[model samples]
Target: MQLCAPVGCPYFRGMASVVVEFSAQEPERLARWWADVLGWHLDTRSGTVVQPTGPGVPLRFVVSARAKARKNGVHLDLRSESHDDQNTIVERLFNAGARFADIDQSSDVPWVVMADVEGNELCVLEPRKVYADTGPVAAVVIDTSDPRSDARTMATATGMELAGERSEFASLRPPSGEGPFLEFLESESGPEGMLRVLVE
Candidate 1:
């Protein structure tokens, strides 16, 4: 399983890129819902929707024919600046129709897991320490059917430039370098059946 650089196209522009693929019985509807929620525009030509990223990776949504088998095994862990910020954002997401998942954050860890409209899981994490100095987390590879296409759609919506693409993968980098390179992978068992980010 080799990852590829992004291919040059009209959508390639900025830096960070985050790609998310959804396995839905109704891909177009789900994609449209996410587009509105993320404040992104839909690229009808590509049948994908994108949310532009400011100096960060763009968010993308891909449609799959399969139904979600189970809760996503591997998902994103987004870091928030503070507790108040986390609460505020979480409320916003909930109002936007995001469902909360079970996680024990009261102990020490500073993160919460939540599911999107389709029941795909994602995490909202708090910073490790107060004003902790650290580099942004790189790309997160979610399980998907077509990562390259998804990456392109994200670039279009977010206004981020497409960097390059390799054999089975695509790369998008934002100016801040705070976002991860979203990659799509093919699976024989279908998108929703597996939780592993990488097969190997």
Candidate 2:
């Protein structure tokens, strides 16, 4: 389906889009809550939640029937440019009702995990230098119904080319090699999705 642009949206243009589909029994309620939390809008008519970051940066949420089983295999990892900045953002998120995840980072790792209002776990990491100098921090495994189909849609929407595909999985690398490699895996359990992003 062709996406219609929202009038006067600040970020209505971009070359990258990230779409995460979550399975919720009460799709409307969940979507509404997330829309408010993320400062996005909801198209209740279509039952799709979307946040347009820019012309190309589209963050979408799709609802399904699967119950949230366990911690997400793929979690969004956000990073800040500096410690002070990270702390500030973390505090803000916490105050805004985000729950903390028990991820110890005293060992020199760059990131920490936290849970969203719905108990969906996400990570907040340090600067890219930590990963660049220290190597990969973690791998995200995306659980989906049809990984190949989802991967293809993402590839088409984000202008990212599919590097490879396995029996029931597909891999996508962001435009910049700096971002994490996103792998899509087929799951019968339901739509438990994850994503990673650079905060600042």
lDDT of 2 by residue, 1-200 (tens): 12333322222123443444555565566566556544455765544555432221223455555656576656655545677866765776687678777634365555666777667776666665533421122223466788888778767765555766987898776554434445687777534343332111
Which regions of candidate 1 are displaced past 4 Å? 1-19, 56-62, 103-108, 128-176, 181-200
The 0-to-1 C-alpha lDDT of every candidate, in the order given, reads 0.50, 0.54
Let me know the TM-score candidate 2 reaches against the reference structure: 0.53
Worst 10 residues of 1 by lDDT: 130-139
Query: Candidate 1's C-alpha lDDT?
Result: 0.50
TM-score versus the correct structure, for each prediction:
0.55, 0.53
Error of 2 at 101 (Å): 1.9
- In model 2, the clashing pairs are 11-54, 12-54, 12-55, 13-54, 13-55, 13-56, 14-55, 14-56
For model 1, give the RMSD to the true fold. Answer: 8.9
lDDT of 1 by residue, 3-93 (tens): 3344222223442223444456666676676566545555556545444433222333554656776655345555456788778767877
